[model samples]
Target chain A: MTGLMRRWLAHAIFALAAFATPLLLSGNRYFAFIAGITFFSVLWATGMNLLYGYTGLMPLMFGGIAGISAYVTIGLSANGWSFWLAMLVGSVAASLVGIVLGLPALRLRGFYFTLCSLVIQTVITLAFVYFVNLTNGDVGISHIPLPELPGGRQLAGTAYELVLATIAVIGVVVLTVIVESSFGRRLTAIREDDGLAETLGINVTRQKLAAFFVASLFASVGGALYAPYVGFISPRSFDVLLSLNIWVMVAFGGRGTIWGPVIGAVILAPVPFVLQDYYTIKDVVYGLLIIGVVVLLPGGIVGGVKRKGRADAPAAVAKQAAPVR
Target chain B: MSDTTLIILLSTITTGLMLGLIFSLVAVGVTIIYGSIWMPNAANGQFFLLAALFAWSTSVSWGLQPALAALLVIGSSVPLSYALEILLVRRFYDVPNRNISYFVLTLGITQILSGIFSITYGVWSDQFQLPPLVPGVTMLGPFPIANNRLAAMLIAAVLLAILFALLRFHRYGRALRAVFQNRDAAALRGVNVRGIYRMSFVLGNAVIFAGGVLFACAYSFDLTIAWTMAITAFAIMIIGGPGSVLGALVIGIVFGLTQAVASIFASPTIAAFAYLGAMLIILLFRPSGLFAR
Candidate 1:
């Protein structure tokens, strides 16, 4: 069998298992909700992996991107828009914002890029609070409406879970394709040596901007799913902590690998839910775990398990069979 | 525009100048670490917060005066910063993309600091008055400004002057500069490159601690103070240019003044945006920093 066929077969099995999870939980609404949210986390982790793991953008700004979409989604819903339409508008807005911000921002190399992006995240999140007319200035647009199905019924419970899960699987498949595409190869080159890549005639700035745009789109996806899933949207929801939380998920799961982010989200998304009783301890445990993982398993668990412990793991995979090649 | 507005602007500028001095106190440490190590220490703000709290603990909990608390912080923070450097940060030196690794590592430390502060202190903000080391308000023409702010500004100016003098003339500072300029050359010249790294690390924490102590006296602090202070300090550092004390001094005041003026037209949060917005524009022109180290 060809490597491409074998990889597709493996992906097919993974998708089947993921889709079967809610069913395996006996169509339990609550379990479905948890599973759906975890899948959204998978979406987020994958986005971070694309930006930081593949392209090596530091101080990766997720909250600002997510906030941009959430606010848009809330604003659209408040204006009596449908959930699906609002989600698309919001995600597209986030992508545009990412491109605009990432254009000049990519000009900043190394530490400056990270610092400048951090400021952008702060300014974007704060802008939501500043523009009182637009974001309602901290009170936030409440009672955001969810998407309706073809039957004119609201999405909830098992159906909502199934819908999100199915979309997530599609998202996974799309991302897998992107990762193995020619663009992904260019990103790896850019990450390895921006100057070298430029010397080799690659448009480094546009590539980085594209990476940011895609990452922002995914963040918007997370926000879109999050807003309706929780039934509320607030500036506080997209605070700095949320950005850091997303980073932890990506870092802990492993970067530069397709499955790393999903595995990370699955492992971490359940922490607060499981330790609901010890609410105070959740952050402490999470922080310690992240530090431990970053220090001991820099390549993340997947990387550690595979004995690569770095992006070299991906390099090794490429040696075996690279689709882009 | 109006006479009242002019007065308000003057007062705001003065206030900003005072605040800027303290901000440079924070930025100086960050700049030194970055200049020396090529690693942007994101946890500098956390160090300041911790040091401020350490001073508060010593002064309030242990019944020592604030000045004494400041001295004690200097004595202890140096060691604490060194220990963290050796234990957690040293491991990243040989890693590929250590800059990114250090960024994340410092972020993790920031989280740990936040977590520890939450558990130990319950994530609360309280008015921190450092015993009114400088009491009453002083009149600048017609405006009444707090004497404490003037005191802080004075201390800031003195500290900055001392830093410049040390960097320019002191043997240790010269060694640090040599290391920062070219670590390989410095090592060849028997400059104790590794030792300088430790010294710079310790010194960064010490300055951040001092800045924290100063800020705590002027304002109240909560868990997120580090985030705000760190961000503001970073903006100031960038605006002033990296490793330039004079630049930090002038720009820190400029940021404060801008914030003050912004608050007149917009909210406090919006005012902050004004500084960050300017910093962003400036970064386009000077990606390395506004001034050379």
Candidate 2:
């Protein structure tokens, strides 16, 4: 097929796949909502992948950023701002926090920065719980207004799925554009070797901060959208668990590739539903799966396959770029 | 001074010191493991709770003494932890993701352990006690020190001293330290890196076991206790730096005091937030921590 035809065909296929989801999961709002979250999680995971996978910055605080975004959005809406405006504000605030945290955090390498993210997550979780007047002190912020689409349609129930799907698609496109940009190349370079990148005239700090901003932007957007869709916002909803869940998706699908996290979400998101009957052991299963993946399959399913595919390729001609780089 | 105010002040300091010791125990476990393996295991707290449960259950059912129960639990924890290290932790060493993977792996374990414990133990309040190990409150003029708190403090000091001695003077500790400072160098020098790694994991759990036994005696335990202890201990470690045992001790004590002071002057809710706030400020200003090296 011609390149243009292939492109058009891919787009059509993607659209069909998106539309087919509701039809396949029909009548179960829970399933539909989960599917929506899976997509949103894919976005979140992709953001993380951009950091950890593409940029080699494995931040464990993605959930904190998301939680903060949700809280901020809910707080703004409670004060009578429009839902969209509030979400926008929340996203910006979260991204800014991300940049600020990243500035100091980027100085650390590998595990140290990850530790910093954990500390950030803990601190933020405590902030939510302690600020009872604002966060309702574990009662959580409830009954957040759902997004409003054109034609007076409220973005809740089935409509919420459509809204989520649309946003997810746009998010993927934006991520793809950013991934292919010169700025992304700089991040890749810094990820490969910060010292080398610095020597080569790349602003490593700027790139790391930018990557942090980008990652937090997606996470916050996901969180802001999530609150209204879930119709409630709780600090509990966004914890280390959620962050790990997102990380699992990213890691399971493959990292560095746009399609990997989406694929991961598809495979793993419905897992809890399938095992809903085994509620108690679900955590055990989840735990084993995370450990198994980390130990047995570091490359993830797709990543492993891709690595195998490239094994025989001539190293001299092949790209010398790091995965994160 | 009013009786109520004096009591409040006394309790705060006493509670702070008790909590600080518990925090130190757990933080030392986490730090030692990190020092050796480079993986910060979040499951330390969960393992702690489990160790406590084992101790409590055996003691209640079989009528074993509290000290004997603690010894039994700590003894079992070493082997169980060794098994875990071999089965789960060893594989992650070469994994490119490093600490985050370890973080998530242990987090998964945390969920599993907590869930299992809650299911088995019924997620209700379970408190343990010791029969006057130190006997009677000692009054130093106006300040009264409870025997329980005094005993806990003493036991903690002894355990910490032994741990330091082991790390500072013992052959095994030297092997462990050799493995910790640089694994490759240690391996080249004929230090059994894998053996040390397994031993470190076991020792880490033993420390946690000790902490858990003391913790149960000091406070109530449920499924949430692990997380509660985990967060506070985590704060202490972060504030003090990840690899410093002494830092963990000092920071744990300082955090405990700060938390106590906050609770006395403000609400308990605010106290918790203040602890977290202190951590954030430390991280913000001194991310290397107060004593990281």
DockQ of each: 0.52, 0.52
Angstrom error at residue B230, model 1: 0.5
Q: Given candidate 2, what's the lDDT at residue A55?
A: 85
The DockQ-based CAPRI class assigned to model 1 is medium
Off by over 4 Å in 2: A4-12, A24-26, A311-325, B1-6, B92-97, B124-149, B187-190, B268-271, B274-288
Interface Cα RMSD for candidate 2? 2.5
- For all predictions, the C-alpha RMSD in Å is 3.3, 3.2
- On residues B40-122, what C-alpha lDDT tens digit does candidate 2 reach at each position? 78888888888777877877778787677778888898678867877888887765656777777788788788768766777
Clashing pairs in 1: none
Evaluate model 2: give its lDDT: 0.78
The numbered model that scores best in lDDT is 2
Kindly list the per-residue Cα lDDT of model 1 for residues A205-305, writing each as its tens digit: 88888888888888887787788787777777887677777777777877778878778888998777888888777767776776787788777766666
